[model samples]
Target: MSAATPTAPWTRTRLRTSPGTATALFLLVLLTACLAAAFPRAVDRYEDRGLRRTLAAEAPARLTVDVTVEDPGLELTPEQRTVRVSDPVTHAAYRKIAASLKAPLTADPHESSYGTRSAEPMPALDRWLPRIDGPPTQLTLNAQGGLADHARITSGRLPHGDYTARTMEAAVTRDTARHLRLAPGKVVHFPDLDGRPISVRITGVVDPVRPSGAYWSTAPLLRTPEQRSTESQPPTHYWTAALLLNPKAAAAILYTTGRAQSYWQLAPTTDTLTARQLPDVTRSLASIANGPGLLSVRTATASDTADVGSHLGDVLDRYTELRSGITPVVSVAAYGTGAVACVVLLMAGGLAADRRRAELALLRSRGASLRGIGGRLLAETAVVALPAGALGLLLALAAVPYGRVLPPVLAATAVVLLACATLPLRAMAAHRRPHPHGAA
Candidate 1:
């Protein structure tokens, strides 16, 4: 029988020969890969946390779209001119404007409030005592969309539909009622520009469930009365408040006042927002403000002069500025850490290469080709680096899973490739130099 063929030394045996070096190299590679995979994800988490905090603390008015159209009644068609203010056709026109204003908002968990208010304040007078005149008050006829949801009736009940009646039903806040000494069943009158007295009967007193809530921000004056004084020998104190009226009375208020301002408040919930959606939200807000969305709303409502106002863009801009200020600092820190990691990795690789130099030289002397020796070194390093890198990446993902996958994947791949290439390149360089004893 032929002699058993001699087999080359196993790769496992070579690795087992220097268990300490292998363990150290594996640990170094694992740490580097873990940091590479974790940095971006950590940054993303930090940014998301900051974004949520900023949004939660911001006022509702800064993040809502407030659309206002003045004197919608003046845009009535010739055929619509003869219709009564309480007619369904007239109500439909105002509803159409509200629908147009709400059409552009596509964000989830959003709320809207639309109403008509007299453009100018009228002096409020008690019907029973004509001599006592109180502060100026504005009449606002609003749909019960989110009003009842955010306010609680303390005295009577929500205003009922009395659009066709001579006196419209209204509700006043607890503060307003107290300040004006008004209560349920009290009759209040305001003289319209047409010289006719517009009468309203208070049906209830309301208190806000959450005074600081976004819903209240839509109509601040309704919850908190405004106080103003003129500069004179004795400053005359003036209080302004808004009286909430049934939605059905919108056309009557507009018609009686001759000109009224209509408002649509669109408030998007901050809880539904994410850092990834920042750019999209900003663009959507901008589109609603001046782009095709605004044009479409104007065209649909047939109100060419309607104006859309929002501070959402400005809020997003502040966020961008904050991010920009922080990004460079984070980049510099990452670069510094990466440079230090590279230096440490290079030192470790150099040590490992130095340790294997004698073995490599001995193989070269035994007629092994330089390519063969370099290939063995590369294979050994890859055996340790690739799996360690993968495990590190898995650990990072399990810890903080928030950022784009591509960046972390590329970082781990680059680290593994560098680890694989380092040993072979260093070995090849050391072998190429001329030996003083002319050996191998």
Candidate 2:
């Protein structure tokens, strides 16, 4: 064979040299840091809606309504009738009675006593009450905010004076059929303020009431069923009204003024007792049994009660201090861990560097300059670390949502590793001191 060809060190050695090992270590550290930075952004994104709502509701407002029931204690009458028009017990009597008949229709002319108890053939009527004689009476409010300025009609208002009926009138939705165990065509009864019986035809059905444990009004009708006879119906009662205000004004109003008589603060952070419990407490205080004095005034907005600006400020202030405290501790821990990893890596790189030093010196002794050595080191590092750091970042982005606690740290680490991989290879290469002996 011809004299053994001198292979160039760069061509001889693969990418797994001193520069490559240093680059790998740098990338690993960078992955740890990148994840740390992204965590807060994710958290803030999730809470943004809640924050805006709270800000709106907490600004301040008021609502006041007085409720009065015509008869809290109603007596069951002997003429308990079902919606069936064919039954002799109800239909015969309805046809025979005068156009304007008064109360106390008997169950039967011969039957002496009333028995609400269920018989073997049929269960007791779902509810035991006096039978309504005829169709419902109705009052169609021509004006918006019919009785109260803030009253909202949820459903069932046909044009004013739509029907003329001998019996009292009331409105019913398809859902009312289910509630009273009647079909769409069947009639159901309601008592007017004058205690005259009225019945409603099932008109329509829309969105059902809110689920039991939710905040907000869920009653189906805008106005309670109205009796058909204008002369017999009582003046409409005001049940509730929602007051509107600017968010800033609403925030202060919770503490300062509310015709509502009571309110309470809701916690803004997690989904829990704060939203459900505060509204419950406010309502409870306003209940007939509980005096309004027991009520604690509260803020109400269409938005989340917790997202009030003050609540967010409180959360941010606490989080800032907590994050401030945690960042230093984490930083120190990361630095210490990185230093240890770097030390371990340096030993390996140093060993690899040492093995190449003689060959490197021989080159330096010739035409090769120190800058050439540094360039070679950088080239080697890039070959190893660049892909590793990039791969780590790709993996991090993929794994962001699934990560438990260290997403932010992982992100920060990625940046750190990239910085090290790209900039420090030359520095590491320049660190070598001159060897005292001649080139090996």
lDDT (Cα atoms) of all candidates against the true structure: 0.71, 0.33
Query: Residue 12 of model 1: what lDDT?
Result: 81
Candidate 1 C-alpha lDDT tens digits along 391-433 = 9899888888777788888888888888888888888888874
Instruction: Give the 10-residue window scoring lowest on summed lDDT in candidate 2.
Output: 111-120
TM for candidate 1 is 0.83
Tell me the lDDT of model 1 at 334: 97
**Number of clashing pairs per prediction, in order:** 0, 51
Candidate 2 to native Cα RMSD, angstroms? 20.3
Which candidate leads the pack in lDDT? 1
Q: Candidates' TM-scores? A: 0.83, 0.36
lDDT of 1 at 104: 33
lDDT digits (tens) for residues 378-422 of candidate 2: 566555555555555555555555323355545555554544443
- Candidate 1 error regions (>4 Å): 1-10, 77-110, 127-144, 230-235, 272-277, 367-371, 432-440
